[model samples]
Structures are given as structure tokens and as C-alpha cells.
Target: MDHYEQQALRELQQWQIRMNKKPSLFNGLTKGLQNKVNNVIPDKIHEIMTSAIKNIVRAALLGSEFTTKKEVPSGLSLAERERLVRERLRFYKKAAATEGAATGAGGLFLGLADFPLLLTLKMKFLFEVAAIYGFDIKDYRERLYILHLFQLAFSSDARRREVYQKVLNWEATILEFPSLQAIDWRRFQQEYRDYIDLVKLLQLVPVVGAFIGAYANYHLLDNLGDTAMNGYRLRFLQQITITPK
Candidate 1:
């Protein structure tokens, strides 16, 4: 048509192109993060969860004898998720200062008690929180898939395999354990009833828990492993006092 119409058409086409590129751009970012974990700082995978003080406390408090009575959902609520991460970091720092200890080389022996049913409840909580904050996910499915990939890839295979069997060990007590397919739902509910209650309580705060949940889900379930790996790699990169000629 005219010059003005041509300009408008060009702008519209540019917007369309951007919209089309969005998914790939997001996936590329996700993949980049995943690569850092898979290739660079592979050791940092389980360290994030276990090297913290709160984790030890939870393990001690929950005890090896604890058992769930129902199916526990496989995610966390927002506030609880935030609390979980913050507490873990806090504990990690305190442990480091007090003990001068660090996450041991090679994956630590993590059992169901290590990851905990609370973490799963926290994940589900995060989903609701994201929704409350008007967060939409074109690439959520991709992120979730990638999260699983990271979990599977960087995780200690021995421990991973052990936990898979333990999921069966508590089959009656815990519900819908994370497997190739969803396990029993009723057990999942009973297993994480406390976490569910906490999620419900946090819901009373309107979108506060939801906001925390959204970020935690995006970070932990989506980006934490890769982020931790990247951080470690960046640290190593910065350690070069001199470059080779």
C-alpha cells in the first residue's frame, strides 16, 4: 500500500517474529543452564540439598523411623519453599563457619529422608503461587522436563536407584512417589499432610506465599542445579591468577 501502511506492516511482522522466537529463546536459556550443570560443575548437584544444616536437622527430627500414611503431592507451596531454601542456605553457611566442612566430593548418600516429602509439597505450593502472581508458562512443560533431566543426570545414580526402590518401600505410607509414572495419589496425600496443611495456612496470606512459590519453582525446580553449577564454574574461571601464553 502506502509508506505508512508499509511501516505498520513491518512493525507487525517484527512483533510476530519476536513472539515466535520466545519459546526457543527460553529453551536456549534453560539448555544453557542445564549444560553448565551437566558439563561444568557436576559435583554441585546433590550438594545444594544435603550440605545444609536444616537438612540435617530435618533428617534428625523426622528420623529414619518416620512413615507417611497417605499420598503426598510432589511440590512445595511458595512460602514453605522459600523458607526451605533460605534455611538450607543459612544452615550451609553456619555449618561451613563452624565446622569448616563442605559438601563431600561425590554425591552424598541421600535417601527419601534427605529430599523429604516436604520438598514435593513445596513444589505444588509453588505452582499455585505462580498462578496467583499472574505467572504464565509457555515453556513450563519444557522447564519441568529439564528439571527432571537435571535431577536424573547430575544425581548420584546409586542413590537415585536406591531411592527408586525405597519409593516402593513406603508405597503404602507415601503416595504418588516420583517415578516414570505417577504412583498412588492417596499415599502422596497422607505422606505430606503436614506440608499440605502448611500450604493451606500460607494460602491465607493471599499472594505472598504464591510469589515465593513462583520464584522457588522457577529457581529450584527449574534453574537451581544449573545455577549452582554455573556459580561453581564462574568461581573456577575467576581463580586463574595468570593466563597461559
Candidate 2:
């Protein structure tokens, strides 16, 4: 490995160590406030958001339609895989930024529409990233890994660590991770929505909405893309240690 690849591997190891560590006291406090906020949200809105997010994610996990990701050339090295991943991230970031700008400029009605549209963009980008990493998204575990990456990005600090541990243990459990419906969809949706609530809400305001939407969506994609790259990196290096030479 050259300088960059060695540095990346070292960083990935450190990241996993951080991921596996238990949440700090500050994390607990933040999550507590998040819970308080979630509690005040109307049950009807919670139910609606939960139902929508669950259905959309379930479709991504179980439906072939979501896997329209074309085949990537196989047998790329770690550096090559990440190079491809960066390429995909660049494209998705711009698309998300543009979508956010358009919807944000359209006022509250269209700003509301950005939620689902942006979700679509995020999911599609995950599909492409997984393919570039040489994983078959048709497999249930890989799809679940995609969801785990999503949760890692947007969940509270406490849940993010928990989710990352799951990602680390995935290889051991992927074959037996139970049914998709077994997940706590309510918690998943609430955490995600609450995490982005304030910023996304700004996207609904007049005049400033367009800038907030574009900037928020752009950075959201940036964060998600980074999380995903490390996630796949974690998997790749772990497999390397186990593979028979």
C-alpha cells in the first residue's frame, strides 16, 4: 500500500475503535433532549413519518426495483473501490444540492416535497456505492448494511455508535439477521427526522429557504458519503484479515 492507502487504513481502524466505544455522558444528554423533542411531536405526524420511512426503506431492502444500480467492474483494489465511491459521491452531492435548491425555491409545498425526493437521492447513491464496493445489493444483508449506514449518518450520537457496532458485527450475523419487519421502524424514523428536523425546517421558510435547502442537502450528502466510504472500508479490511491467501 502507498501513503494514502496506508493512512486510510489507519484512520479506518481508529474510526472503528471510536464506533465501538460506549456513548459519553454528553451523548446521553443530547439524546435525552432529542427524546423530549420527539415526545412533543404529534402522534399522527409520527405515525405518518414512521409509516412512510418504513415502507420506503422496506422497499429498498426487499424490492428489486431499488437495485437498478448497474454492474461495476469487479476485482478492484481498495484504493480503486474508494476512487469509484468518491466519483459517485461527487455526482450525488451535486444532484442533491440542485434538488434542494429547486424544491426550496418553490415554497412550503415543494419544500415539504424535498423530504421524499432527497430520501430517494440518498438511497440511490447508497445503491451505487455498494455496487462499486463489489457487494451484491440483491442480498438482504447488504441492503441492511445500506440502511445501517443511513442510520449511522443521521441518528443521534448514542445510536450512531450502537449502529456502528452492528455494522462491525454484521458479517457474523448477516446470514441470520431476522426479517425486515423485525426492525424498530418507529425509532428509526423518529431518530432520523429529529436529527435533521431543525435544518430541514429552515428549508420551508421564504427567501432563505433555498440557500438552507441547498446547503443542508449538500452537506448531508457529504456526511452520508463519508460515512458510507468508511463503512465499506471497514468491511473490506475485515474481510482481508479473514481471507485465505
- Taking all chains together, each candidate's TM-score versus the true structure is 0.20, 0.87
Off by over 4 Å in 1: 1-22, 43-118, 121-245
lDDT of each: 0.31, 0.81
Off by over 4 Å in 2: 1-4, 17-48, 242-245
lDDT of 2 by residue, 17-131 (tens): 7666776898778777767767775676555556667777877888887785466887888888888889889999999999999999999778877888888889999988888
For each predicted model, how many residue pairs clash, with residues at least 3 apart or on different chains? 28, 0
Q: What is the C-alpha lDDT profile of model 1 across 93-203, one tens digit per residue?
A: 333222211111112332112233335333333333222222232233322322232232223323333332332233242343243234332333322221122222232
Q: Which model scores highest in lDDT? A: 2
Candidate 1's displacement at residue 150, Å, is 16
Question: Which consecutive 10 residues in model 1 have the weakest lDDT in total?
Answer: 98-107
RMSD in angstroms between candidate 1 and the native structure over all alpha carbons: 20.3
Give the Å error, residue 140, model 1: 23
Candidate 2 residue pairs that clash: none
